[model samples]
Target: MPATSALRKAKLTVTISGDVINEIDEIAKEKGNPRSQVMEEILRDWLLKSKKMAIEKDIEAYYISLTENEKKENREWSMIATESAKRTWND
Candidate 1:
């Protein structure tokens, strides 16, 4: 869930360079909306993407933590299954 909900709005203070502010304003104009709304939507999208990336990193770390023998066994079993399947469906 997002920190800011429909019924819950929080104040935030952000400092950006003038160029960035102008870019945001330009995007807001292009989208026919206020700069604040554009910034909020962009920030929300970034937050969601950052969360997904963090989750992926954690998953990779977990995969790396598996025992070496376990990984080897899993790979060997997978290859055997692939070979068996190919043999059963010979062209």
Candidate 2:
């Protein structure tokens, strides 16, 4: 993770369960970082995971929308690509 100084700061408050807060604090202490820094990393990871899931969902929908003929063509192309990779690797 980048230094906190490299990023703009936004101050906000939210209520969390005591147990969760304790866990966050423990992790922060172990890492020699502040609670806010730990929280920032957690939120960043969550946002990245959400983005990846959204992209996956979009790709799934696109594949689902393809016609049978288009699907077959894609499979044929994939096989060709795989064979090409195999030949290249065997050389």
C-alpha lDDT values of all predictions? 0.91, 0.98
In model 2, which regions exceed 4 Å deviation?
1-6
Scored by lDDT, the top model is 2
Instruction: For each candidate, give its TM-score against the true structure.
Output: 0.68, 0.86
RMSD of each: 4.4, 3.5
Model 1 ranges with Cα > 4 A deviation: 1-6, 76-91
The per-residue C-alpha lDDT of model 1 at residue 91 equals 64
Which window of ten consecutive residues has the lowest lDDT sum in model 1?
Answer: 1-10
Candidate 2 accuracy as TM-score? 0.86
Position 90, candidate 2: lDDT: 100
Root-mean-square deviation of Cα positions for candidate 1 versus the true structure, in angstroms: 4.4
Name the 10 consecutive residues with the lowest summed lDDT in model 2. 1-10
Tens digits of per-residue lDDT for model 2 on 43-69?
A: 999999999999999999999999999
